[model samples]
Target: MARPENVKFGVLGKNIGYSLSPKIHKAVFEVLGIQAEYDLINFSKTDLSKADIDEIKHQYKGFNVTIPFKEKIMPFLDEVTEDAWKIGAVNTVRVETKGLVGYNTDYIGFRVSLERAFDWPIESAIVLGTGGAAKMAVAVLKDLKVRTIFTVTREKGGILGTQTLSYERLEALCPRTDLLINATPIGSVQYKDQMPISEALLKKQKGVFDMVYVPEKTKLLQLAETLNIPRINGFNMLLIQAVAAESIWLERELDVMALVEAIGPKCK
Candidate 1:
C-alpha cells in the first residue's frame, strides 16, 4: 500500500544491454502495485571505485550486482550478509538509510531451483568455472552437504578446496559427477555453441544446469536434452534471486509467481 516513491532499484553490470533483469524487476514492481524503477548501471572494472559505489548506494534504493563485478565490488560495500560473505560474492545489495548491505540471493536461487527440478537430494556436482557465480554455486552445494563437488577451470593453481581438472580429465570425471553445472559464459549469447565441457561429457551426467539463461535452452542444455538428461536453465535461478532481492528492497515478500508470469514472455 506504500507509494511508488518508496521503492527504486536497478542492476549493476557492464555491457549488460542484453540482460532481462530490468524488465523482470519492473514487471514485479507493477504486478505488486509497488512504485519502483529498475534500471541498469553499466560500469566497467575501472569505473567501480568507492565513490562510484557510494553514489550508486545513494541513488538507488537497492541494486543487483552482475557479471565481472560481483566479487570485486565486495570491498566497496558497507557490509555483507553471512551467505554473501561465505560465498565471497554479492549479487544483491540493499541500500538502507544507515549504509549499504550486500547479499547473495544466487545461493538461494540455485538451491531452490535445483530442488524443484529434482526431488532427490544432490550429493555431488561438477561446477565449471572459478568466477563469482561458480563461488556461489559451490557455497550452495557445500551447504547441501555436497562436499564431493569438483571445480573445473581453464587455469590451474590458487583455487582453494576444489580439484581443478583439465579439459582432458573431463571425460573421466563426467560419470562420477551427479550434477553438471555450467557457471561460465560459454553457453551465453556471445558464446552460443561453446561449452565448458564437451557433448560426450554432458551426456554422461545425470543433470545439467547452466547459469547463463539468455539463450534459455543453451547449447549445453540442448546437448543434455539429446542425451535425455534432466536439465534446468538459468531463468529459474534468475527469477528466484530477483524475488529475494525484491524482498530485501521492499522489506516484504512479493508474489514470486506473479513476477515470473510477468517476465516469462520477455525471457529468451
Candidate 2:
C-alpha cells in the first residue's frame, strides 16, 4: 500500500524559478491517480542552513535537490544512502519520523539514458560542470569503462579525480571525445540562448546529452542537431529519476518507461 500520504514534494536549489519539475511530477502523479503536489523550493545559497534543511521534515513529505545544493545538502540530512555517499551527492531526500534520508537518483537517470542511447563505443567523454549532477555523469562514465573523462569546472581548481579543465581546452580536446554531456545549467530558462560549448566543439562529438530539460531543445542541442550528431536530452532522465524518487517515498517499484510513454512530449 502507498505510504500514508507523501502528497508534498519539491525540488530544492538556488535560482530554481525556472524548474519544470513541478509540472512533470504533477503529470506523473495524475496518471498514477495520486493526489499529490510538487513545488519548487528555491533558496539562496547564503540563506540556507542545516537547521533550515532539517526543519523541512515538518513542512513537506519529501523533496528533490538540484544544482548547487546536490552536494551542499548532504551534511544536513539525517542519513545518506551508500550509493549517494559513494557519489558524494544527494539529489533526493525523504522526510520521515526518523529524520531526513538522502539518496541519489540522478545516477539512475543517467544510467538509463545511456542504456537507451545507440551503442557507441565511448573511449573518452567531456562532461560539463563539477557539481552533484556532474559527479553522477563521471560515475556513469566510469561505469561504462570510459578511459578518459574530462570534467569542466568554472573555477581554477576542480574535483580531484579525472582531468578537470576549463572551457578553453574543450575545442582542442573535442575531437577525441565520443560523448559530450552537459551537467551544467547553461541551457535552462536562465541561459536559454547560451551554449557553453560552441558549434565548433559540438561538431567533434559523436553524441551529445544535455541534463537540462527545459525548452525541450537547448542551444547546445540545436547546434548538435545541426552538426548531425546523435543527441539526447534530460527529459528521460528527469522522468526516470522522478519515478525513482516517488518509488522511494511510496515504497514501490514504479514502471518507469511506461510512465514516460504516458506523459509523452505533450509537456515539451
Candidate 3:
C-alpha cells in the first residue's frame, strides 16, 4: 500500500513528556521524505482503558510503548510476534486493518547496543529486575552464550531460568559477573539517586549497561564511570529500537545501527 500524504505516530506511556521519541521518529520520517507527526500519548491522567487503545489504533499508523505498559498493552493488541509473546511484552505496535500487531524490538535494541558498546567477553551477567525489559535483556544474554541470573525484590524460582536473588544477594556474584545489565528503571526519574547494585559490586564488574536513558547518564552509569568501569547508556538502545519499530511500522527493513549514526543530532 502507498503511504498517505501525512500520517500520525506516537509514544504511549506515563510521564513521557520528556521522551525523545518524537524527535527521533520525526527526523526519520523527514529524512525518508514522508510527512508525519508524532506525539506523546500519556496515559497518566486516568487508566488506559481498552476503549482508549481502540481509539489510538484508529488515530495513528502505530506507536511505541514504554515502562509500566509494555506488558499491560499486550492483551489489547490483536497479534503479537512469537518473540514478543515469549518475552511477554510489546514495545512497538503497528495498526493494521485487521488489528494492532505487537512486536518487541527491545531485544534487538539491547543486542545491538551490546555489540556496539562492549568489545570484551561476557561470561556471566546479572540482570536487575524481572520485568518485561529484564526478560528480553536476559534473552539477549542467553543467546550470546552468557550465563545469566536475575535479581528482584525477593527470591523466586523458574523465572526465565533457575536463579532469582534478592537485592542483598547481588554482591555475592560480583567476582564472576562480567557485565551488569540494569534492566530496571531504578535510576530513572522516579528513582533518581538510586541504583540496584552496591558500589563495591559495581566496581567489580568489567562493564555496565543501564537501560535508563532519560537522564542520559543515570546514577548507575555515573557510578560506573566514577569507578573507571566502561559503561553505555540506553540512549542508543532507544534510537535503535525506534529504527527497528520503524521497520515494522513502515513495512521496510532499515539498518538499525547505521540509522542511529544518521539520526544522531536530531534526537537533541
Candidate 4:
C-alpha cells in the first residue's frame, strides 16, 4: 500500500498529556518529509472496550500504547509478535489488512538504550517492580544474556521469580547489582520523591536506569550522580522505540541517527 496523504497516528494512555511521543514522532515525520499527524488519546480504564478498539482500528494508521493499557489492550489485538507475547504486553499496534497486530518495541528500545549507555556487558541486574515496563526490561535483559532478579514490594511477595525485598535486602543487593533499573513509576512527576530503593542502596550501585523520562534526570538518576555511578534516563529508550514503531507503521527502515539528530534538542 502506498503511503496515505493524511497519515494519522497517536500514543494512547490515561492522562497522557505529559507524554512526549507526539512531539518525537511528529518531528520524525516532518524531517522525513512524510505527511503525518501524531496525537495523544487519553482514555480512562473503563473506556477501553471492543468498541474503542474498533474505533481506533478503523480511524488511525497506528498508535503507541502505554501505562495501564499496555497489558489490557492485549486481548483486543488480533495477533501479537513473539516478543510481545513473551513480554505479556503490547506497546505498539498496527492496523493491517488482516487485522491489528501487536508488537513490543519497548524491549528493543530498552536494550539499545542500555547498550549505548554502557559499553561493557551487563552480568547481573536488579529490576524493581513487576509491571509492564519491568516485563519488557526482563525480556530485553534475557536477550542480552544478563541475569535478572526481580525485587518486589513486601506486600506483593512471592510474585513468581521475584524475591521480596525489604530495605535491608536492597542494601545487600545494591553492591552486587551491576545494573539497577527502576521500572516502576516511583520517580515519575506525580510520585516525586518516591524511589523504589533507598538512598543507601543507590550509593553502592555501579549504574542506574529509570524508565520515567518526563523529568529527564529522575530522582534515581540524581542519586546515582551524587554517588558517581553512571546513570541513564529513559528518553533514549523512548527514542529508539519510536523508531521501531515507525518502522512497523511505515514498513520500511528509517535512519535512526537522522531521526535522533532531528529530535535531539526537542527530546531534552
What would the TM-scores of all predictions be? 0.90, 0.93, 0.93, 0.91
State, as a TM-score between 0 and 1, how close model 3 is to the true structure.
Answer: 0.93
Each model's total of backbone clashes: 1, 0, 0, 0
Residues 61-113 of candidate 4: C-alpha lDDT, one tens digit per residue: 99999987888899999999987998888999998889999999998889888
What candidate 3 gets wrong by more than 4 Å, as runs, is 45-47, 154-158, 172-175
RMSD of 3: 1.9
Q: Which stretches in model 1 have alpha-carbon errors above 4 Å?
A: 1-7, 44-47, 157-159, 171-175, 255-268
Scored by lDDT, model 4 comes in at 0.81
**Residue pair clashes in candidate 2:** none
Error of 1 at 261 (Å): 5.6
> Candidate 3's residue-wise lDDT over 155-206, tens digit each?
4542567377777666765555788888887898878888778898887788
Model 1 residue 142 CA deviation (Å) reads 1.3
lDDT (0-100) at residue 153 of candidate 1? Answer: 78
Model 2's number of clashes is 0
**Poorest 10 consecutive residues by lDDT, candidate 4:** 153-162
